[model samples]
Target: MSGAGSVGNDVDIDIGALFASLRRNWRFILVGALALAALVLLFCLLSTPEYRAETRVLIETRESIFTRPNGETAADRPVLDQEGVKSQVEVLTSADLLKKVGAKLDLAATDEFGKPSLLSRGLIALGLKRDPSQIAGDENMLREMREHLQVYNVPDSRVIVVQFSSEDPALAAKASNAIADEYITLQRAAKLQSNDDATDWLEPEIADLSKRVKESEAKVANYRASSDLLVGQNDSTLATQQLSEISSELSRVRANRAASEAKAASIRRALETGAPLDTLPDVVSSGLMQRLRERQIQLNTDIADLSTSLLDGHPRIKALRSQLADLNQQVRGEGRKILKSFENEASVARLRETELTRELNGMKAQAARAGGKAVELRALEREAAAQRELLQTYLTRYREAASRTDHNYLPVDARVFSRADTPAEPYFPKTLPIVGATFVAGLLLLSIFVLLRELFSGRAMRPIDGVAQAPANEIQMPAADETAQPVPGRAIAEERAAAGTEYPARPPASAETIQQIYDSYTTIGDDVPENPHSVHAIASRLIETGISRGLVVSPEGDDGSAASVHLARELADRKLRSILIDMTGTGAISRTMLDGKTVAGITDLLASEKQFTDVIHSDHYSDAHVMPLGLADPERAMRAIDRLPIIFDALEAAYDFVIVECGPSNAESVKRLTSATTQIILSVVDPDDNAVALSALDLDENGFEDVIILTGAESSTPTPPSGDENPNPRPAL
Candidate 1:
């Protein structure tokens, strides 16, 4: 967990760390800022300087003229008009005025470029290429010219200021004056043009309209004359009178004709009825056919009444019938007589018509006389039309002449009020402002770069800077077991006394059997120990570093393990001839550690198949030789430690140190081997416990001795200790 925590805390960079980084790399920041400042300064030096000149212009109102119509005084009018000021300001920047300025100043010639002057060539060589086309009359020059002349209204006043910036002060002033001059000239020209255009258009229009009026009048007169239209007031009354007279004559003729026919019918009826003509009523007054019808009705009534009471042969009935027949005959005769009377009446009507026709002819003659006057009037109308045409022509010409005369004295508004003056300066490259602005820009860029760099770097400092430290504790080693039975000597007795247990003369048959007897002790199991010694001599020296009581060794530790190999070499260099016993059934130790120098090892010695002297390699060092652990069967390796006293007695007489590398400490064979050794030396990495080295030192169980904590090497963090006031503090442990 400590190891995990250390890894988690590794990459954090706190404020202190950041400050340290800054302190260490301060040069980079200083260089960057200085370089920026230098660049800004250099740009300022290279940039062209510009100067400004300002002038004020007041918009002239009607009141400002100081003279007015009717001789009014200037004090009588308002001092300033805002609308007029705005209008005049707009005119100052108008395209028309600018174009006029362009023309009047011969700007076209100044805008073009010739072959490069020596100074221009030098400037070009310096990477400042000035194009001839850019200098030509275009938007750039116009813009530059405009920039030199700034026109603005003065606050709370009718007056406006015209400010300009240029390389030459006098030129700036002149350009400003020129803008005002050109604006006035443009105003005058525009007014004159407008007035002239109006006059020109009106001239031809007046002449043409006069001609059209004359032609219309002539057409009206000629129409009146040819149609003989009596346009007098009484003509309508006369026509009405003539119509009434003709109607009256026709009515009278019809009445007379009716009267005559009636008279003729009555006479004929009297004759047909056998009445005397003298006895007939005046049918002329009554209407001839009407009277006959009345008589017929009376006869018919008598016939009908008589037939109802009398037979056909009766005299009264016969008489009545005769009367009805006479009545019918009278009616027929009256009808024929009326028709004849109509013919005679028609002849009489023709005679009256002839007389009326004569009268009508006389009236027509009078009408013709009036119509002849109308014709004369038409001739007069034609003469009037010709005169109107002539009048219109003359009027049109007169109007044209009048308009031309008015144009000759064009309005005073067209008068030129001002003229342009020569400019004295060019306007561009404002020096102080450009340089100051560059400085500000450079500062901003530097700030942005710094901010971004700080944002992206993920760094934090350690959390335990002011925290208290924890105390260290000693590590313990595991106890011996059945496979690691004791050797016959005082060292074994000492191990037994230190552990407060009785010495077992013979090893247990199985690891479980030994575990049951020493239940209080957590013995090392059969696995390669983390930091095991290959030689007992090295183990004894490690024990001298502290104290180790009950020692456990494993057979697998003799070889194949880096720790075991290192221990064996260390022992040999310390002038000790160590015999490494491989009790694990594999001859890996002898092959790897000894480089296969001897074929016979512990297995051969234990089996008595080869003498111990023949298997052991003598004189590895001046004072010691080594008996390497060789290949063994599992059961045989387990039992190999039972003969440890014999091997040790042989080696003790010849050498001062006898180191044995045993199988894994947890194995039964290791217990047998450890019971023979002097003491145990437990090697542990400072920050590891899962490895076999720390497991063997079961500090919670069997305990340990001479535990040397070997920390994996690392560069120490630089931190000062508290108190003591020492400027140069000792390094942390």
Candidate 2:
């Protein structure tokens, strides 16, 4: 039982099953394994032995002469990562490398890997030999080398191993050593070839570079010579300096001219306003002019005094005014002379400023032309600079490459760390492994084959699926013993009565066993009917037989109500409308329904007081509609049940199935519904329930198309009453 439940656990493995299978079919495994091992031994003995030779190679990570710390080479070499190491490994096993080894050894001409077998040798002696060269040539030799060659990295080391196999031990060693030596020699040769190639290419490139350098430099010189910029080695031209010097001088000259012009204008303003000649600094600074101002003041004082003492034209006043006039005239003449000199200086300054302006403009024009020429000069210089830099770079590279070609000291990154030796023993024809593997594989296959054969033969017993076969007497048929099902279309009536098709006469199982059976029953019953034919098997039988009405009848037990509910639910789950008519007036469905309460039901329809839709209530257990005997008087419903013919006819026409829950009290209605229905499932509480068994047989005799018994448990076979006494065997309900 534990083993049976483990199948549902899904995580547990059944080791007991494996051991049991092995124990049962030990002979098959032994015989099959022995036979296979003998065959493997025979093959090993006949096959030719192969010797393997190995060579070890170490990849050097030493610093290069030119690339070592602070050496001339600019860019640092990239370090090999895991992928890079793998790439190097690929190079060792490449087809081209194998092809090179094959060509050097001339294995194609020798038919190295195509040695004639015994049969072929005999055929060849009889002048039936094929062309050896045509049979095995360059392509075959290359392929053989590729297939036989194996290169792999030594774990946790910077070394790789190359292995090869051959019939001849010495040949194997020779081939492996040759491959290693060729790989190293190939690397050195490749580098030397690259150096020589670089030298050849660089010679022409350097010449072109040198020519470009000279041409660019010459352009700079020519541009300098053609233009008048006269640019110096200091990056400044003479015209620029001259422009600077002239601009300074012009500024000084203009300042001087402006000073002279300002003085002249001030003197002219003094003369126009007729201001005191002493107002002029030059006039005031004159010794005679200062004396004349004093004399003029003295004369004006006298004139004022005389005019106060005498008449308007007094001699004294006239004399004093004349003196003042003379002094004023001298001062004016001094001021005029000073102003004239200033005018001449201003005129000279104006002429000099004009000359400087013309000279400055000429210098600016020349400087503008120099600026344009300077741009060309700078361009030429840049070209020269770039050419020189490129030439220097190529020269440096070419010199290094030339030195390498001259001194042929090319070192390979990898070398032979260890040379392969000739193998004394054959590496192949491993007799023990071959035989052991054959035996194990053969045993496994034979075990599976035997188990499958026994299973299909209906003899294999697995704890997971229960005892494969029950005894023929315990079950009803030999075939039914293999699977818990009746033989197709051949159910034994006795088995049907004991299992389900017929009602039980007695309780054969204990309470727990009956509960287990009910649990399994309800388990399958819960599935919504995605497959209608399976869930509605009973209803389907009736429909196939062109009948739509069915009855679940129990005369001795009350289990008919439950059976009827199950049948109607099954039919409803299949998307078929089913009405379970409880004509027994038990209200059993009402009591069992989660929220159900009985009310006046089917009797109302018979009395014409209610329609079928109004009185019908749906059952919580299933989608099936229930027409319970309602709150109406029980006597009325019992009497109105005589109208069941019309009611049953209407239900049959309206629904896919109508399951009538019948009791002994409603036996007449049962008979009428049964006659209308093509199917009748006789349900009993226990297999030993005597009354329903007798009623089931009577119903069958009375022409019910199907009288299926649903027994509650297994029971003993009971004797029926003798012949004519039981001719009409409808037990009193």
Candidate 3:
């Protein structure tokens, strides 16, 4: 059995076992450590010693210190320094370079790493070392030579390291230095070959490109001279700009000429219709018309004066009227002169517009010829531009290539900055470090083995230690002031009895004292939890993990029912369909606390008197429900639910949470419920007596998985049920 001993709501860890595990297995640990040390020492002693020698090569990215460094980038430094260094390292360890070194040193003729001891040969034959090539010659030795050489770059630096190892110290140093020297020579040879190749290919290509560039430029000049398409400041020809200006001016002149003609025509219409000549602005503003209008006004005044003072047949009055008529004729004559002037001006504007239109048409023809020539000139110019760019590129590359050839530039990226010295001691077979590491490894393994063994050991396999054990002197009896209330299902049995139906004759259950339980509800202003937060936390975990249903139990079974009811109520507050089921076979406490009677419960449902629908009752708080244990013949009811898995499954499926207040100290009920559930909470009468309480639980015998403790809050205590009377029962309806 796996026991989780809890304090409050947290399970206590047995830290003592971790320390005890090491104590009990100290001898085994000592023996293992000693054995590992011995093996390391033996291996170190037998291992062959070899000397290592290294040489450092400075990888010059742009220029060497001997040559004054400049801000200008090297002509050949296209790649980054890191990449260049990596390439040099690969070149130094290349197979071709190793083959040259092997031939020069006559490595195949010499006897080094050629014959191995039986143990080494066995390890090699087992393919620990790669199988050597079958071909027997300098090629095979060249491959072996590569294995002895190591090349790498120093961190954050352009310097490369060339290392070699051998039984002979002098040979190791000599080989390392020789490889570095050979790499430099190879770099020089490669650069010289590249410069030679570039010069040979580019010499003829550049000559041809230069000739083509001259030809393209000549053609561009000749085409420009032939085509009269002169380039303006904005790439447009002057003719194009001139033509656009003329076209806009001609449009404006034509518009002015049309307006003048229209005005003159309007004046002519007025003269023909004998409309008032004063209506025309030309006529009204004329000096002659204004003078005539003044004279007419004077004549009319004279004629009126003469008529008021003399007889109607006066010759002087008639003469003055004749003078007024003559003045009016003069005003009409002036109006005619102004109209004639407007007609002549309009006729001149029409002739000027005709001349401009003729000139504009000719200019358009000239622009059309120039435009065609410009298209051909542009195509020729594009080809010339392309040729010029290519020629410039060729000249630059050719000059650079030629300069390198003349200077005999050594294009090596790295030069040897330091040479390797013969090593005094072997770099391998570190005895002390090997021994220490092996000992530590053995100790680690031994600790794990001992701990696992102790974990499954009989003494550590104790049942849960959180069982609530009341003090020996003070038994957890029911509350003194409260006795049992009416049994909920007692009335259902009575109704059956009155109706002449056969009934279970068992004594009615004593109802429970329930104020303490009801007060546990936080809604009523009392929180009866040692840690309300922890209760909610645990409830959330249970709900999250799909436990949903479990029994709350105690060793003495005194306050377990009260605790169970409180937990169910808290779960209901979280909006879960949490309900309490008094599987105590006595709904006495339930009826008293709920202040309600069970109409028909599990017994009636099982007996076919009522269905499950008729038995479920809503509690006072939220939507939480309660299902009481109704009265039935004890023997038949127990037998009917002997396979209680079905009944518990149905109840769990029906509610989000089904809290079983299993009658106290019932291990069988706990086992049955836990098997069908994922969580089990154990309530305690006295939290201080944890160890004694845990021992009383006998969890190993019960076989429960998880058990949480609801402790230190004895404020909500349960009372004993005193009544044997049957409570009221309603019909199935």
Candidate 4:
């Protein structure tokens, strides 16, 4: 039994024995490597050396502020983007530009470009090949120049690199600098041609615009004369100004008429009511009334003096009383005349007011007519102004274009920033790298062969009897049927567990196995075991592609969401930095990852109610992070949905793999969260689910060609019950 056990253990490989055999064969590996290196060194020595020189051109518009056209700024200068720089590269390598450079360098007469092969010359002499005279000299030289020229654009910049190679170092430098100079000259010539074209185009346009402006101005003047709409001061019509003046005069006349009438009525009331006339302002202001009142007062005083000196029937007293009565009669007559004069003044004022009012009405009618004609006049003026503006713009452009063409102010869009210099060393046949690489490769190959031979010959085999004879650690597992075979990965995990060690993380499987997993997703029956369709397989593929972000979709509702939870956990188990974002509003991920706790999540972040640090929560059962859909209003959250890409970018930068669980989401709904490299994983519980097929087809049509379908046992994270124990419990009626 002991001999059989030792023989059984002989099949095991011993890493120590393999290394020992390799050490014994060190001389063979060294000899082989030295021979390979020697051959490479000889080849380098025999190869002809070619020298290369380069010139760099910066493609940009070099127009200065003073030289640029009016109303043009630096912002208006054309920017040379990547494609623009590439276009400049094509221009540099063009046959026309290269021919100019070749002619300048006299390349066609040089031996390198002008001379044909000896075999070709021999054949031509024998009439077996086409005669050399049949081919054009320029075409032959152009072909040779193109073969020697190398032009390319620098990545993410507006610089182009021009390189030339030749056996003569001085010729290489001269050719490269010549190419740059000729290309710049070509650009300047093209600009000059464009300016000439612009000047020719603008000349006719400017003339036409000037003619239109003159015609429009003449039409405006003729219309103004016919309609009698002459412009007055302050840009108003003459009729309007006259009407305004008449209206002002009419107002003054009516105000004076009213004042005169009021004064006449006041005097009349005083006469009727027996009030004092002297108290009246109009009566007191009159000189005639004042003199009359003084005379009457003197007569009264004389009568009083005579009554004291003479008898009651005296003739002097009677005469004085008669004089006083006459004085009162005269005062009454003067008061009547003053009242009549006031009436006359009121009458004249009223007549004048009526005449002015009629004149104002007539002027209003004339002004209305002028306003109607002024509309047409204004239309003509606007047309004239528009034409004048257009003429001025054309004249400005024509002058600028003509000035540029006349003064030869054309500037090329590119300049040589770095000119080529003669190189002292050859560019090809790097000696050290070639020899060292050959020696390392030869040694590594010989060592691998020796190690393989030792293992195949059983010299590297070691007996495992000692380990196999040791007591096996017991593993506790659920009881199953006897016919049930263990899964390969799970059995390995169980064996590791039994030996009191953690299950090791596995690297990505082969491409064939990954393709098989994808095929099994479409073809595997519902009765198939879940281990083959486990989320671990998807995790391995994710690791293999180095995908940092994934959009998880669940077509079969919460069941698929559970699978995404498992995927996140499986990725975390593999020691990858993974996070699960729960976009599903059903709180399925929250129940599993957060144990039914309501926390701030992506919706909260979008709503600006929480930040990234506040929303990302640690998974309760695993190392994976969880971002659950929070209590923020869904409508409000969707208002800021445009910010989802920024959130995804931040998460991708922070973690290795970000898995977003979108329950029952379509391509359009999740389009904002995906990128060109984002992996799409469809988590479905049933293999035969019709929703899975439909969703897959929809995703494929939407440009997601590599949709990964995760169909396996439901997530071990427990789903919430149907009753009211849910965190987001439904409200009762």
Candidate 5:
């Protein structure tokens, strides 16, 4: 039952435990809070604030009316084109427009500190800003301006917003409005300048190009007149005639040269003896050579026929031989004639060749001259062509410019849709929001710090409850005093009567039996039963129970000296014989229990100054006696209890129950007296006092038979009905 109660009690929680845990780790929580606050303050101090201003612009596009061929106006034209509105919105934020805005605003100027006024100081510190000259060269002023400005089309709408921010509120608002106005003005000025410049530049260019075109045409006419070269009729006839004449002359010269070369070669060959005449084979087999050979063969055949008919000695044969000889001679003569003809032809060829050479040279010289003239004319023609092309280009440009100027028509969707207006309030580091943001940021940092500290610390613990209501397994009754009730007369009388009839009453049992008897009487049970060892009780039919004895033991040396009054009252209610002995040389316990009654105590008894019995007081409990430590010198109380053995022996013999209330365990006197006690029960209230008690127990080294821990008594009503009446109800110590 006790074990189950303990298990149930173990699950209970104590609120005090949580308080105790916090108390133990107060430093952690406090330090965390302070550090968090400090970090919050630091962040709040370091951060900067930003604000923005925005202006909205509406884009509108109008459709133009187109006249039909018959001069009828087109109907059902769309008012605003979505694509045109989108394109305008895009153009408004374009770099070209923004550049003009920057120029109009004179954004390149610096402040008194020589720092660029339009650029952020933070950007400059971070080395993001370039030199002003470099910025100008790259036309980067617009880029820098755009960094501070933002343009966005409102979703599902044709409205656009131009937002800008600056450290200075007024400057931000001014710049925003200025950008819008300058963009519109720049568009107008750019269009006008472009058109005017186009017209101004094209007029002289077109006139000069026209003059160049006329000059080119005159050059072309002059080239035609100077050349006078006919295409086919005249030149072709003349060239054909010349070619025929040259061809005839060349053929004649070639034949003559061939014959002359052949004659000269033969003569040279004859002069130079043994020289081989290596004539061409084709020449030998030519038709002309074949005809000549055929004629010679026919003549020879006639001569041979004539020779066959005539005798060798006949005049006719002689004449034929002579004729044959003559023919050979004639052939030789003809050969010579041919050679002479070749020589004459050679002479003619030489002369003809010389004349033809002169003529050909003349023709070549004329051709060279013509070619040079053609080259010059071609150069002039190229120049004229280039001039004509340039003229055409310039004339076209000039015409376009004149046309545009005359028409004076703006491009579609070019007109202004919205104008900049002055803002009512400046935009910049907003005061309320900045301060509020700082506070919020600080709090956030503080919370983080606290959370981190909680995560890292390790001092939290669980709680306990219901200790006061938990059942007790051991009983602790105070020492008896004068107020204690005596056992009932009938109960005592019955016990005596049964004892007389049976086994005679003998000397009392040992302290162990006394302890047992105390346990039984205090335990709740049925009425007293008869002693089986007493025969007379059965014969007389009288139920008699043996009288129970109990000991009201105090702490080893504490007795009940300091707590004697309370102990006496508690003992009286329990109907126990309780005696309080102040073994120390102090009469405090005796005086307190007896209500200031003067009592001779241990001091007087030990010195033989007063009898031991004379110091006892019995008013506080029915069967209880109080003996003070006596009014001895403080030095005697400090003396060792081993020196006072007689006093302990006398008290043990005189009382059925002895309650020795000694001094604190630290006193040399108490340690010595602890050895004389059979059991020890320690009274304690303060937790630290328990430590002292444990220390004293350790010092003894010899373990006591019993050690009971007691809480200091407090004056209160009897235990409430629902509370445990006997927390440790086994027996009193």
Candidate 6:
């Protein structure tokens, strides 16, 4: 018979027992592993060997500099990206290309691709699989080829790998290489067909473009002629050129008229003022005026000489004077003639300017009319130029297409770089790995089965020491004492059950475990207070130092617990929110503060029997809150006692001071509740007691340098007021 032991409803598993079980069954495990390895090896030896062969093809633009289009360079060759390479991989395995390869290799004549297997035929007959025979002959061959053929692009490269598997090594290599060769052939065939189509399409397009070119040019010529938009110098219209020339001539003629008029006016001024004719530039430039002036000078010289030598009325002197007078008259007459000639020149210049201005105006009007017509002419020219450009482009393309068609020089975008070679070894049924993996797997599986059998038979289980065994379905509540409180959820369930409503039961908590944990804490039974004045001092220190949380160690049991209550009440009196947690085994703090009311507390929370809200109760006689010792198994609650610091943290956040009264504890016993910020207080009726000194020394050794020894009155209740008329006497403090 098998027997199992459980502690708190958990089965205890023994590692030593499991190892012993494996030791006793080693022969069986070894035999099973060897049998599995032998079977795998035999299967490997009997399986048909499949030879795999591979061929590699590089996909890229194959055009050389000389064979490329007119304007294309070597750098302009299209390189395939990964997607393009993958597209070429699909092309390599295309149905049409594979069919060609299959026919070329005569794969349909071989047993591999010739007929369906007997099993496959049977399955097809039963409608369990599709029938290959129902497909066409070419499709059947293609389908068979697809199963054996593998095409994929190499990672991050334009190289595609084509592989084929067959029983015959030579056939594998032949089929792989044949597929690559046929793929290239198909690429070239496609290019050739495309070129032929382009040639056929371009013939009509070129002819139409040629006709358009001729018609557009004729329209340009006709428009130019009809609009009379004849181009002259610098490609400008004839009317514009004539207008420019006439305007220049008019400006020159007007300038000449102004110059002549100024000159004629100056000569007339000289004549009327009787100024010297030689001083006038126009008069001095005249030949007749200059001669007359010369003659007058000569005659004046002769008269002066004759008057000095002969009488005033001598014949020689008389002749000289008469000639001088005649010369003077001739000078005056010559000046008038020169002035009149200048006037006539001015009139001629004015007449020429008027004629030229009239011609310029006529030319401008003709040019303006031609400008409007020239806009239409320019539109025709642009259309003709565009058509001519399009025609030239078509002619170039048609010539290139025709040349290619005649030469049959279409090049494929890909080429076979490495031909497939026959594999020397079979590609599948690796003997060593198969046998080794089977052996390891079988050994592991058999070992697990043995362990499970041992565990299920209860031979691998042992009783866990110091763990209380209890029934899973039964819940044992802590025995009722002066401060033992009922679980909140259980109390609610009891009430609801009494009212004819059922509530779901909570999980069971072991009561024996909780009581053992509580009873295990050592307590001092002396309850007499030693120093009453020290309680006020401790409270004042706690308030002044702003201590939010502390661990209270009581060496004198209820007396020390009563001091903690007094300290909490004193802090409350000082307007600080204070809460006291009773962690003593005797429940002294809860008994004094709770006023005989039963409420769930920290132990219930730790045991998962009640929530925090259901565990905290208010003090009856003071403003402080109190947490009682709960009715949960202390052993199970101690399992979760590590959560005490978290509870202190939550109380510290809500209250100004959180004080936990530990009845009798050393440093190690309360280590979880202590931190750097937590103050340690030793509460004793006698400050000099051996136990009190030992507790303080223990806390000091555990890194708590500040231990406050508080001694106060034994009675937790405060004194009543003296006045009978006072309506509200002070409550317990």
What tens-digit string does per-residue lDDT give for candidate 2 at 408-439? Answer: 75667787878989999998899999899999
Residue 297 in candidate 3, Cα distance off native in Å: 28
Winning candidate number (TM-score)? 4
lDDT of each residue in 1-733, candidate 6, tens digit only: 2234444755577777877999999999999999999999999998878889999999877776786778878777768788888888888888878887788888787777878766778999899988876777787778878888888888888889999998899999999999888888888988988988988998898899889889989998998898899999999999999998888888888888898889888878877888777888777788887788888888888887777779978888888888888888788888888778778988999889888888888888899999999998889889989988888887887788788879888878888999989899988778999999999999999999999999899988766663465777687865656654332233445666798996578664465644443344323213434343476677767777877886889875665666788778777766789888988886756766775555788889899999888888877767888888888888999999889988888888889999898988888888778765677888776666688778878888898777887775433333333332335333332
lDDT, candidates in the order shown: 0.52, 0.70, 0.70, 0.81, 0.53, 0.80
Per-residue CA lDDT of candidate 5, range 51-140, in tens?
A: 456666665433244311223344443344567566666777788777666665566552311235434555666788755544553265
Residues 528-556, model 3: lDDT tens digits = 34353245555666787888777766543
User: Which prediction has more favorable TM-score, 1 or 4?
Assistant: 4
Better of 4 and 6 by TM-score: 4
Candidate 4 lDDT (Cα, 0 to 1): 0.81
**Candidate that beats the other on lDDT, 2 or 4, i.e. the better one:** 4
TM-score of each: 0.29, 0.44, 0.46, 0.52, 0.29, 0.51
Deviation of model 6 at 2, angstroms: 24
Output candidate 6 Cα RMSD: 19.9
On lDDT, the leading prediction is: 4
Q: Write the candidate numbers in order of decreasing lDDT.
A: 4, 6, 2, 3, 5, 1
- Give residue 141's lDDT in candidate 2 (0 to 100): 67
Overlapping backbone residue pairs in candidate 4 total 0
Model 5: number of backbone collisions: 17
Worst 10 residues of 4 by lDDT: 724-733
On TM-score, the stronger of 1 and 3 is 3
